[model samples]
Target: MSSHPILHANKTSPFGDLTPDEFYQKHQVLHTHSFISTNNKIKLYTQTWRPIAQSQAHPPCGVVAMIHGYASESGWVFETTAVAIAKLGFLVCAIDLPGHGRSEGPRGHIPSVTPVIDNCIQFFDEVRASNRHLPAFLYGESLGGAIAMFICLRQTGKWHGLVMNGAMCGVSRNFKPVWPLEKFLPAAAMLAPNWRVVVSGNLVDRSYKEKWKRELVRRCPRTKRVFEHPPASTALELLRVCEEVGRRCREVDLPLLVLHGEDDVVCDVESAELVYELAASTDKTLKVVPGMGHQLIGEGKEILEEGFEVIFSWLKGKIKK
Candidate 1:
């Protein structure tokens, strides 16, 4: 636990107090939504925000496509960052993964990550097509970070850079399911893929340095508490994803910014370091903050502001905005 604690205001959005358009007007941004059809025919929820024309006389600086972590959705805390980026004269878009948030699918269950990545690629491809004249970037947190990296690898030269926040490059030893459960994952998954295992209660506790932030995350209606643990199938798939990513770290040639908490117990900092060390990209940076946990957004205001400052500065430098 971090001793340097700070209380944060309950995160609130204008969506409740005003209409969608009214909220965007008040914020000086343009907000739009689309129900994108994925390869699996899943009607995924997608949204984008761009600065109002008056906010930036120059054409938008760039376009950023965001992917949220497992059990998380783009419609909640993640939207805060999207809005901030849009207000900074960048067009930002995000999609809710099939099984999460407003997207259509089963709750808290992902049998495989392929379809999810496919969904993001489809939506992000559409966004990229519309903004072909602008530089493009990918931003992801936790599992989404790995997905973003895979996407970049699959489509070289497509992105100007990648921003990974506490990405799940590798699972931490502290959070791995117990001995028998971990060892039996493959067989168990085959037998009962959808079965929810009794693991990872500690993730939420270790993720947010602040208790209130953890509580606030738990209160999110769109993300249920059941998401705390990966379903048997998802768990097995995650291990494979990490293994494949670790093996192919040298193939990551895109400009990258990988941020992780030195003390993060969910996604090991060592994994981030490993990626940093082996990545073929010439323009790559790794920032490991001591005592910080998994959720940078849940950090103290001072730390949170500094983290975003680092991220935005890096993005601006890479995109040349």
Candidate 2:
């Protein structure tokens, strides 16, 4: 825990003064990135982080397919956490979803959720191809949480366990647009799918508990996307996706861990609890830390350590690694 990379991060960079290459070397992890074709034209950016190999064979305990939140990429500060997990002896891989990072699409535009789910499945499946002998788990943060749930639902029995960090199981009322606008989103979406809607507050202001950490997100060199509010169609699609996930909670049978901030102003804490309550998985666990906000890892060392420990221990226990 003392060696966790995130602890070393500063407001200016995910690696502070260390170059990306130096950071990976210092942590004793092998980091690599590549692009995978979603089709003949679209290529999704992907990353892999693995513990530096020892003399012994089969050191990796499991494979973790990570999903980052909306308007975020698979690298930057997110990569710091990925390094933290890789050093824990698990294989971790993530992809920049289309429209969010380097992947080509209209900026901040997601007309639907189904294609996003499919894109993740395509990338994650490739990551697990050679590691079939190891247990497979899904780890998602924010909107990634919903994507992870949808993946498990769509490909039942394929995943050994799941982890959701500050999951957007449902939107917080505090973040939603006032009354009639929220009611009119679907109609507005049909009329102008590309138009961005007005939400109550800035997401970054509400997401990170620490001021510097919030600034760090804006400094992300990759992606360069600090999403303010979703376009109408994407906003409507997110609501629909949330509703579907809620309705299918009873169908979630994978070993699950739900980590949420009790005071999260973006995603409702009660909605996460509802998922935990209704999920059919007997092995599920939920930890809603009081006073924490939407982005758990973004809160810096002290606040994040416990939640991260829970995630680490939970993954290790499930695979008995």
lDDT of each: 0.82, 0.86
lDDT score for residue 50 of model 2: 92
Per-residue CA lDDT of model 2 for 38-127, tens digit only, reads: 853578889999988733565688899999988688998788889888888899999998887777777777788788889899888887
How much is the lDDT of residue 136 in candidate 1?
Answer: 93
Residue runs of model 1 more than 4 Å from their true location after superposition: 1-23, 54-57
Q: What lDDT is reached at residue 21 by model 1? A: 68
Model 1 pairs whose backbones collide: none
* lDDT: worst 10-residue window of model 1: 1-10
| Reference-based lDDT, residue 106, model 1 | 85
Over the stretch 1-321, how does candidate 1's per-residue lDDT look in tens digits? 111112213534314456556656766888888898777877999999987883335778899999998867897667767777777778999999878989899887778888888888889999889879889999999999999999998889889999999898999998888888999999999999988876755567777787667777777788858688778998998889899889988999988999988888888899999999999999899999776778787787777777777788887887664
Judge candidate 1 at residue 289 and give its lDDT.
78
